[model samples]
Target chain A: MTSSTSRAPVAAEGTRARLIDAALDLFTHCGFAGTSLQMIADQLHVTKAAVYHHFKTRDEILAAVIRPAVEDVKNLIAEASAQRTPTARAERMLTGWVDLALRHRALIGLLQTDPAVKPHLKEEQNASILLDQPRDLLASHLSGPGRQVCAQVALLGIVGAASTPELRELDDETLRDLLLDVGRKILGLRRPRSS
Target chain B: MTSSTSRAPVAAEGTRARLIDAALDLFTHCGFAGTSLQMIADQLHVTKAAVYHHFKTRDEILAAVIRPAVEDVKNLIAEASAQRTPTARAERMLTGWVDLALRHRALIGLLQTDPAVKPHLKEEQNASILLDQPRDLLASHLSGPGRQVCAQVALLGIVGAASTPELRELDDETLRDLLLDVGRKILGLRRPRSS
Candidate 1:
């Protein structure tokens, strides 16, 4: 997904965009349960009704905030799945997933740690299947009993690493490179040679 | 730390143990917010008053259930802190931590993912200091800007890896060795020579 900060102002200039931005800020700092429509409105200097006009519920706002990142992940999974070789798929998935995570670092942390958001992210219904598809695809690339476990941990490490506050100060390119380097080691993949 | 399953029956025999066991099961499966004292009591076929005798509230039961694992971590950190060399400390911390996570696999997942349990685990009062000590110690072992980020992600990877369901089937020796190997690589530590 494109960095929200880098996106053109037009996509982020609308009332809906404003609400999502305020809600994300509040949710990240105060947590999903701690944030309310009134809080979002207060932060935006608007009425709760103004916030409600764009999103009927907090969950709706959360879904909106997470949609872009989720879509990016879905697209990454699809692209990786199309690759014929497991090695090719692993390499592509690693680079794509790391880029997605670095681009949306805060959102990744919230998705992994926030309880209220977690159920929504892992509901096992239509949207939840999207979450599992990438993991299952990763598993297919691995062999042996430990392979699944290694793949899962490697993915967690990369995403968790990208989302760390200390790592946030690193430029995107540096952070992406370090994550890819460490992630390849975790997954037992060979590091790419210099171009 | 020893696995609760491997501990003496005395530690697992009492009404308090039964209550904690039931609570962990419910909390892990249903999410901490979804599980109640009454549900824990129901699981054990015990009266609510009986459950209350051991734990006045759900949070109390969670604290008791988490206490041993936390204590194990505290001891490990203390031992690592006493080591003179960063390499020695990293080695001790990594191996000790992997062992602890394997011993308390299910609990680590619950602590990391359960939002209700999270605040209690992270309370910055007296107990929360214990939580930060190990991380701070880990950080001291690494040098440079990326050190903190690498340390945090490496620890997350080790704990997350230890708790995976697929890895649960691997024997402890195998899991421990794999975790140490991958963990050393994550931290940029040199591989140990033959014993």
Candidate 2:
């Protein structure tokens, strides 16, 4: 599969991007149920037909909006799995996951919190598998008894921390440092010796 | 303000309690938007009018469902605030908060994740105040610069960890211990000297 960077060329510009942007803002604030295609079009000062030409339905718009982030996750899992050791894989996955989550904090928050967005997002073919792939991969690298639970909780902590409104004020770097610090501790993984 | 235990006698049993219980289950599983008063009544094998008599609207039913937990938070903050030292207060608030969170994991998850329940829950008088009180209190007890952010993230970690599907399999005692363990580490609070 192509990396997010490579796929960015196809869906990274024009009215498609604008619709995605507007949809995200509305979805984040008003929620999926609260937002309508007309609202998205109105926000962009475009006709409904203009918006409809690119995406036929609200779910299609949502699919477009989340595509890049999901692709990045797919790429992260692929890269991490390619690592030779479980430790290396876990470290890579943790850092990569944190980076992705921070970069798209609002989208991540919506996905986690908004019920309307959730069912539609899940309907995407392979969405569940894609979502669980990294989690399962991360669980494999977690050591000791109850590592599965530990891995899951550790991930929950990282994702939850990143999505919090209170931490929104912290710059990406500061937030990343704190999240990685706590996340590593939760996962029982020490800092890489080389770092 | 009445404690959760003291107020239990008021709305603890009978139709009110049953309605709240059924509403919470439907809300947790089907979400607030997906669940209707009819469905709630159906779940309890009662007519919609029976449910409506107890709760005039879905929002009112939601209010009842969340009231006990919200009250418990209020009591937790009040109790924690009575403590003299920052460490003591933070420890008390942390433990009590975790205990309450574990006890009502599904409701807490719905409150945190479901958007439909949020606005209705927020409409209750003092809802925002009740929600922020514990957070503000927790921040006060947390020391050093950046404590607000730290306190917020720590609470998120605890709530998020407690609500995790993976952690659901573990017994309540084990979950509480693990949550407290990570919660303390996140808040920068050293374990209480006695414990």
Candidate 3:
């Protein structure tokens, strides 16, 4: 009887995670605005009520869907920030960001470029803080009067191009190599050694 | 009476053009899926029926809205394809593309990164042709086995970064210079002379 009770909550948690996963896939392909709770339910072969039981609204589902990625980015920023030198910090940001972008390619694209998703992202606390932290990290090592804009371009360009459909056909290793190479060039950092 | 009759068609044309413009604005900010006929009509202070008189569906309005941009891109491709040398052709493409991206910054963002809009863009006749021509042009000039991926990164990265909110505050001239500088770097071209 005790084991049955414990398994019940675990089963519910599993279903909730499955729903969030299905919603993320739908949101990636159908878009945040285009996806409906009914569609999410259908994707998981459940009723709309089942979806509502977990997420009260589409926005709630969206928040849950993006929460892990946002946390990952914040964690990335934290680690990169801990580096001693500006160059090391920037490199940490660069390599870490490229991996994050690759790992969450579609979700990153949807979050960055989707108009409907932008406002929701902005609602996350300290969105500006997240933006400024990386800009400052990158700007410290980058040269020229246009360093601010250049930093933004390097960061945005790497993730943006990584998520593009044309590059989708390229394997992750190859894509990672190309992105790191171009990202280093954009930031005026030394190329990765052949060794 | 003759003058009034002659002017009626012109007035209709003016309203039609205004509706398309307003729809484009709505689509850029609200997204293709989030936008509705009523929103477009309300933007122009017209009734839904008036919008229906011109467009049977939101898709029709979207087609009308994006037609000009697609035609402009096609024209740019034609002009670039005419250059005798690959270097000149790539240079023309790079310059023309940056200008085009800057001109239609938000619209390009909506068209490229929005998942809901991808299928619609693919439905355009010869979408693959438009993609291949630029890849071939860029491949010819870019050195390395990853030329294809590099070419796409340069093109997509420029437009994608140009459309980002961070770079939105940078003036067009500044954005253009930054994009051209980075584009040339990615493509392995010589830097422009300061003088």
Candidate 4:
């Protein structure tokens, strides 16, 4: 994973978020192929040219969803990275990921299934902005090579949990608590040995 | 919630299994939209009309996929119900479900996200295939309602756990063990009742 070494992280601010929020509404309403640049332009109340000024193509907008999922993950990890203890940092990172997954369920589903949108995700490289952020965040709090692999797998498990239909029906509070419970189980962060 | 009160249990077993297996292969390969009834017929080495004779439309075949994900859950519960001990039954059901999910990852994915497939799936009633199955399976074992609900959620959490991309990469033995560990933690099955 390139981590932060390659791209200076893009903050989820301004035109970037406008493009994302617009894309989210359209993609979820219409299947990805059914959505078009013209629709996005109209969604933003901007002309096609203005939409292009921000994102050159539909793929650009598709790539933008990864920004929020990745950024939230990065923020979680970034906060985790600053913690003094490895265990505390991991617990925070794991719990935060579950919370984010539950909160941003639809967006995560878009990024997961739409084949058109997945490649732009730089999960292995810094490009997998969605995955790498949490990965790097969790890696910082761990020591062994195996732990990195576990954290990477655990991150995907968290995404899968929150994104799946079974998890989707539960109310936010229920979902949040279940995910936190699952996260502790995944990390095997035993209570007391826990956060 | 009606556990197929119909005495026949699975109607037309041979034909239904053939249709579902063929659909699973084709749908996973080409996705729901990309496939056609003719392709399913061709794969089965049967005429298209014969395919229709079994399944009325492409939606019917998509509907068939739902059966396995649900039926497996039902079967797991049936077995658990047979066991007299509560902890033993809960263990049997959770462990069995993890195996089933790993064995059928592609179908599970299709049941999950393939937009073309999900709508026709009738997953809401079938959600009981999951929601109610474990509730019954653990009923014999758990004394309290909260613990029973937790047991059911943990079983789905096992379903959730098996759905991960990284876990998908691991061999079944390793994946099963990892989920068992999580199951123990989530259901409070492990000694010491840690996280």
Candidate 5:
């Protein structure tokens, strides 16, 4: 009985994880608004009740699916925010941001571009605001007119290129270097002297 | 009777224009798959029959809505391709492309990023393939490794910044200059000395 009791939570966790996996695929292809609980259940070869037993609504599943990435971004931003100088902060944020984006390319792409997903991502976890903090910090490092526009477009190039599919074939490391180069140029930063 | 016949065609054209406008707005917000003809009709305060009369399917409406922009891009590419040198070609393509994206910001954004909209943009009008010609031309002008990546990311920045809502507050001319600057820097082009 005790073994069964312990196993129940583990099995439930497994099911939840699988459900999230299916939902992410569906959400990426079908979009958040278009995906339903029944579709997720069918993808899992389970019944609707089983999906409901875990996530009561599609939004609940969305929250669970994106929570890890969002938390990571928040943490990254917090770390980037603590840097002493604009250059250091932008560098840390740019590298960290590129790594996170490459690791979670499709998910990050959906989060950035999906119209239906935005409303569900509350203020603190909002992708736009999360990105804006670092972008604004990066912009502070630039001088002259239209600095904010420069920083914003440069950052978009990084996130956009990382998440975009055309560059997907470039492999993670190569793509990362390319995106970092693009970002630095747009923001008017020189390549590190050591490199 | 002849005047009435001409007026009838003009009125139909007007209705068609209005339906396309409504559909574009709906598709942008609700996503193509998530939106229904009925919802579009409701948005326009018309019967579903009215929408159906104009477009038999949502895809038809989507095609019509984006047709003008697509034609403009194709024409721009043709114009850019006619330039004598790589610099002139890249310059023409870059400037024309940014102007088109800025003019049809939301529509271009949907075309570029929306998962649901891609399949509808078939062989000739494919956004990826259409953008590739210019990117390849620009990359050829660039030397060293990762030249393609540099050009691709630079082009993405121009389109992405124009379409993204965050940078919308910058007047069109300012945004245009900033994006061109970003694109030029990444592509390793110099500021035109005469300017």
Candidate 6:
């Protein structure tokens, strides 16, 4: 057999991703608890053994799906950390965070709401660190105690706006305006958009 | 042999509410697919058999948990439907929504995220109608073309702030300001916290 048939998936476009995509679709629709290995297998038309050959269990699969999404958030934090200006950093962070959230709205939705996984997702090992990085970076430049809270709240407000299906009904332009408008308010701002 | 132990749990609390509570706790912590009846049973100090006796399957348990939360949102919609003032109705709707959400943040969190049970929670017969209530309420008051979308993004922004751990981390006063501010901005208010 060629190497393609023999290699285990560990790249951007591999069996692992395919499994995650299938699982995400099912998990999004059926629920994480509602979905099964067999279901994932069924979605892919592959054997459960084949699915297991990559992920040891469902939790591992769940973890795998969250990793890329979590990394995406981490990357945003990294970009935010790189900027020197508080205004630029805050603006970049908000835009990056919202874009990532809107792109992976489903995963962000799960992170925010899914009761069982919320804590697990936020545990120190997972997205918790990713979450804190921004807080820490923003905190470094912030002036007062309430200011940190404001920044955190502002960024989260943007994420929530981007990820919520209630917001999904919005057209892109309206959504962007709402996000930017809401962002300014959270930051205790009344600046014109072009500012 | 008197069945006293069994009777206490049965008669003292409504079985439906108990099951919903247990499932909500587990669902919030584990993600729907990750949670099991045994886990819910563990929380309730009952057996899987008892859980099954109450809910035919985990799906039913999931349904029961989201039902009340979703209904609360629907009630807000009805209440908004009765109000004549666009601003007042939006305020009333937002107020009722915040009150309802704050009461059971965890359940609302679960209903919002967690891919496992998301589909089932939307309800077949009355799907999106309850969701549309706020959008409609917003559209009635706001005359813009994408007002519906604006309303949705705003509504979600409130919900996201209300339930997020990010928001939960803030002191009550700050959290409240952020939420109200975001809401008013969504409504396109000139001064976000007038009331």
Better of 3 and 4 by lDDT: 3
List candidate 6 stretches off by more than 4 Å.
A1-72, A98-129, A135-157, A160-178, A190-195, B1-16, B30-56, B112-115, B119-130, B138-140, B143-150, B169-178, B188-195
In candidate 5, stretches whose alpha carbon ends up further than 4 angstroms from where it belongs are A1-58, A110-126, A192-195, B1-62, B109-126, B193-195
Show pairs that collide, candidate 4: A70-A130, A121-A128, A122-A127, A122-A128, A123-A128, B86-B141
Model 1 chain B weakest lDDT span, ten residues long: B1-10
- Listed in order, each prediction's TM-score against the native is 0.80, 0.78, 0.72, 0.60, 0.74, 0.64
Tens-digit lDDT track of model 1 for B1-195:
211222222342476777787888999999888988889867876666666666778878878888878788878998998899888788778778778878888887776666566656545323325535555666666776666666766777777778866466778888887787777777767766752
RMSD after CA superposition, every candidate:
6.0, 6.5, 5.6, 9.8, 5.3, 6.8
- The lDDT per prediction is 0.72, 0.72, 0.74, 0.63, 0.76, 0.66
Model 3, B160: alpha-carbon shift in Å?
2.5
Clashes of each: 0, 0, 0, 6, 0, 18
Candidate 5 predicts chain B with a TM-score of: 0.80
Model 2 ranges with Cα > 4 A deviation: A1-12, A29-50, A112-116, A124-141, A144-146, A193-195, B1-12, B29-53, B112-116, B124-150, B193-195
lDDT of 6 by residue, A21-133 (tens): 89877878877778899998778766677787778787888888888777777788888878887766766676666567667878866655554565345464454456577
Which is better, 3 or 5, measured by lDDT?
5
Once fitted onto the true fold, the runs of candidate 3 whose alpha carbons sit more than 4 angstroms away are A1-62, A109-122, A125-132, A192-195, B1-61, B109-122, B125-136, B191-195
Cand. 5 TM to true fold? 0.74
TM-score of chain B of each: 0.75, 0.81, 0.81, 0.71, 0.80, 0.79
**Which tens-of-lDDT digit does each residue in B1-195 have in candidate 2?**
221122232432476688789899999889899999899878876667666667778888887888788778878988999999877888888889889878778887786657566556564434335546666666666554456555655665577667766557788877777777766766667777776
Q: Please provide, for model 6 over B18-123, each residue's C-alpha lDDT reduced to its tens digit, 9 standing for 90 to 100.
A: 8788788888888888998889777877666767767778888877776776677777788887887777777777666656656767876766666566546554
- What lDDT score is found at residue B46 in candidate 1? 61
lDDT per residue for candidate 3 within A112-192, as digits (tens), equals: 545567656545543445567776676668777577766766776676667767668888998898888877877788864
Whose DockQ is greatest here? Answer: 1
**Relative to the unseen true structure, what is the C-alpha lDDT of residue A65 in candidate 1, on a scale of 0 to 100?**
90
The TM-score-based order of candidates, best leading, equals 1, 2, 5, 3, 6, 4
Clashes of 5: 0
Per-residue lDDT of candidate 4, residues B41-129 (tens digit): 67766566666766778887776676666667677778877876777787777677768877777776665545555446564534444
